[model samples]
Target: MRKKLLHIICLASMILLFSCSGDVTDELPALTRAQLSINLLNNGDVDQQEEINSIRFIVFGSTPGGVRLDVNEHILLSTPETATDIDAQLLKVTSSNDILVVVIANEPQSLTSKLDGIASHWTLQDMLYDISDILNSDGQIISTTGMPMIGVVRGISIAPDETQKVEMVIERAVARVDVFLEAIDGGAVTGYTAGSTSVTLHNLSHDSYFVMGNVGNGTRDNADSSKNYGKVKENVPEIDLLTDTWTAATSDTWAYSSATGAKNRRLLCSFYTAERIFKSDYSDRLAVSMAYVPKGPSDVTGITEKVIETITKVDDKGSPTAQPFTEIRRNNVYQITARVGKIGIQILTVTVEDWGDRQDIDLDMDL
Candidate 1:
């Protein structure tokens, strides 16, 4: 009887210990990480939208009102889906802390250094540091020859256990200038030949992160190919400018990125002569210049005079003001029409649009 009682008492003690352990385990909260769903956008612009193979994201933790993200720890995630999980330690936050993130897609693999390995948190200086490696072996800006369809989303807020949905509108970091040669009355251009005219946009900046419109050097309007300028050769599409009403700027395909489609020319943003005058020359501006003669019967000689026209900004009062013109903002379109006898080319208009369907980008067709 004594041995049996002792065994029962020992079993009772074991049950109490196990029950206490279960209670302690229940009291502790489960480990939770911040969940994020990243949705890439084409800014609703059909032209800028491309297929994203994958994306790289960096999450920085910052205390409320603090300028620097915690440099000691960070979360780096490369994902192929629109939604994924990020390490909690890199994004763990208290009530007053916020999260800052920078994401890029379709960028060059060599550009991995641009984010500095995603190991530590970033300071304002680190965040603003420019990547000098944006040049090729010949030192030409990489963005000019071939650029990644850069889509960046910055300054996001996240809380512990919060599932955040983000829209990262991605667009071409460049503007496409569609050059048109036609008669003043919207007739087919008879004199100029296709594949002959090389339009040049001069004095543009090549900085990697020059995201804003106003923060750059002044641009110059020039037509001379001998000087510094960006040129698009063999760019004019095959169209009967005289007969076909080629009024819309993007009526032709805009190959602004390399995303496995016919519209993936992936050129960098060049200096664009603005068609809108709403903002008084935001920063240093540039001009558009091209000189070409109409195709003649091989023997035609005295057509020595080339159409040389320079556009100057006319103010609200309609006067040509020479304050360095506006830098061509990225993802904009400058549609140009050069008439036979007109002194300066007529700007049908400059349009900033989102590429949606055929109708969305060509909304200016009515004008």
Candidate 2:
């Protein structure tokens, strides 16, 4: 599934110097004042309430020779709006020097304040691109403020009398995982029904950078095994029970037939995590541990115990293998599909998707 992203368009209008009678005059210096209008367009379906909570614009000015100047400042444009698309206007006097605009959205108040306190350009860049503490007090992936996003439009030549339209694209700072489970009757395992299932994700990173770069301050890398990940978590648990009504149904699984004659699988769990890489030996790679209990009356006797399985990767024939799932990246979605039967659980497919692109990793395992 694709995540909804926000598209931002900036319109900058700079006015020319005018005489007392409102006529053009060469006697006065050119006016450097500008009025900027930013229209934030929701790119996909209806907006989620917490998708955008606040927006901050930072404008940095430097000399033509790329010499860093002290003319750098940031402004909070406005609180988030409920409309499908939002427009914010900013009027300010800026120099004619080349400017770089950095727009950030949905950052928490504490992080925003900390960003505002930094005075040095290089220091601010370091803090903005890489930081920790992404989790909340409840240990959730992101705070109530929402998913943080950042966009940069640099090397903008701010002329005295010109109108410019700049379009910026913002991206999510975290990755999402969606897990699906289905029970089918086609394989060697039969007469067993779907049951109460629990999906546990392993080796998740807690800290993530605001922007993408090679020098990661949090996640572990495949090349280096000893470096510490920013508080790497193992066996993060998520459990969902099968209701009595669904378990007693005629179908063997929690899937329902669609109008197109396709079975819609049940979503076991979903979550967000920071980026991370597996070790060279694939010892610390990401994985999922699943537990399934047979629900209702089962055809097979003496099956009261639940089955537990850990899946990292599998071969073409649905058996565990040593192939590594190398890395998890930001602004991406990973979907894992598995089938449960009398024998045990079999991972069917794993797919990684970005906003527009998708790739499939076909690895199967029987537990």
Candidate 3:
């Protein structure tokens, strides 16, 4: 599943500079300066379309080598955040005959280090890392957000003074998990007695790394395999479902992979049980057991306490047969569902849905 992503350029006009030959007459029409009308199609979480803080695009000389984002400010860049489309005008020059266009949207200023690291060879992994603990100065986890669509158009050349329309298709670099609580016959987790219980998906990956352009989805030089690129951070907080039928998912659970991987990643989750102590080694694939708090009916006086909680994992399509290991991919949504009751907890998997595309992941999940 280490797939190479191709950069799609909607439109682009390459410009070339040359020395003057003989004295030319005014018969030829005057050429306008190089300009670009950048059209940004909304990408990323459907709800995050309006969250764009700023947009930036860089122009570089087209070569076998790549360009850098933090290198020079004069390569012709723009930060037009308000428009679905932006017009950028560049100063005339003559060193290189071709250029590349890279547009990064909604990037956090905290990652400004990437500005200097942004180059043709750098992948999204090179420019970023995951923040599992969104903590305050006092060390309390905060609700932090992450996601940025990257678009790149390379090898673009324009006839002298001709304007080009480069359509850039930026794609999400990570996967999204949406937890849903499907209680049967008004169970304990049926939004009725949700206050007394807490549930969590274990082994959540906290870090990710990948290359860009036609390069592989993993490390640039297999740099992170042993360090193992991404892993679930220890002591990660549980996902509280609250009063709603679903867990409080203000944003994606984690931003890790953009497509299926050669590795088999599973979401080890527990039933809606009472709050339990959280501990685990980030490096282990299947670490400690999930948390579960068993409790009888709050109002029923004659009812006896419950025990023997059973947990079953189902296929991606919620089939009766559960997968030995649930496979995951990027730019997709995995809805891990739970049906709670006095008997036990059955975890069901809804079909995997790609963020911006309609084709669902085939249940085979074999890369």
Candidate 4:
């Protein structure tokens, strides 16, 4: 009986040992390191002029963990789309492990040019809605005139057991106003020349006049002959000359002294003789030319000139009509140049504001 009992105990011990060994083997496979990988592929042909129609990135693994993605963290290594072109596309990340960046080419038949149409598509509607709480409380127009304001998704997810990749794109929009100043020369007269000119602006709603300058004339000096003076010296009473309010005077000593007069003649003679008048029926039609100035990072190296339009009259309501001018929409980056011109002798003010969205991340992932 004792021998039989010991044999049974030995058999039971062996069975228990085999069961424990099997359990260990099963757990060993689970202990292996999980792998993470990401792959990027472009789905279109190389010759396609359509900007990147679609971009995809995939993550795969045997034991996948739900991945957290940050679209702002992903780097674009190579793209068919230029920085300016990226702003017109729609970006979508379909699945947790799969990312799809899509861009729809603007129809060639649109009223606006393809590039302009693309730029206009970068509307921050969603972003604006998200920040409505703060914006609604404020009364000021958030002047994002020339600013590059990009939108970003802080976090998103892919599959339950895969690495996550982010999705992103550029948003661009442009509001352009063109100005033209045509120099019209009136016949020359003694002591003065008549120059009738007009200003024209395109796509502009409202404008104000700050200063005016004579073409090629140095700074305004009433006593200097080299400078160009409107018709005050030649007219009998040149008080209402340049515009409706401007006039010339020979007897009014104050007016003659204040008007452009020779220094020696001003001291020797008590009054100024009327020469000729530079007359304009529309004071609001004054325009000036300025060297292209870039206030932002966009490359506007080749831009040469910009037209400035001014507002002439105000009705009972404050709405204004933009003076007539030509419009210029070139393919190159627009910049604000330092060299500026004027329509008269007054100082002009220029306002620079944000223009578009500029947000991107440089992501360096080993995978």
The candidate that achieves the highest TM-score relative to the unseen native structure: 2
Which is superior by TM-score, 2 or 4?
A: 2
Estimate TM-scores for all models.
Answer: 0.46, 0.64, 0.50, 0.18
- Candidate 4 has its poorest 10 consecutive residues by lDDT at 1-10
The list of candidate 1 runs beyond 4 A from truth reads 1-32, 41-48, 64-96, 118-157, 186-188, 194-196, 210-284, 295-324, 341-348, 354-367
Off by over 4 Å in 2: 1-31, 47-50, 64-83, 91-98, 128-143, 185-196, 212-263, 293-324, 341-343, 356-367
How well does model 3 score by local distance difference test? 0.36
Q: What is the Å distance of residue 351 in model 4 from its true position?
A: 17
Residue 331, candidate 2: Cα error in Å is 1.5
Tell me model 1's lDDT, rounded to 2 decimals. Answer: 0.32
lDDT of each: 0.32, 0.49, 0.36, 0.21
The true-structure Cα RMSD of candidate 3 reads 12.4
Ranking by TM-score: 2, 3, 1, 4
| Residue 296, model 1, lDDT | 27
Best by lDDT: 2
Q: What is candidate 3's lDDT per residue for 1-367, written digit by digit as tens?
A: 1111222222333343333334644222333234355454444333344333445555556334444332223221233242234444343432334455555544444554565455653343355444232223322222132244445555455565344454545644445444444333322323222343333344445343321331222211245343222222234344421111122222111211334551112232222111111233322222121123232343211111211122234444655543333233444455444444445444433455554444322222100
Model 3 segments beyond 4 Å from truth?
1-33, 43-48, 63-99, 117-125, 132-146, 155-163, 185-189, 192-195, 210-328, 341-343, 359-367
TM for candidate 2 is 0.64
Shift of residue 268 alpha carbon in model 4, Å: 40
Report lDDT (Cα) of residue 291, candidate 4.
22
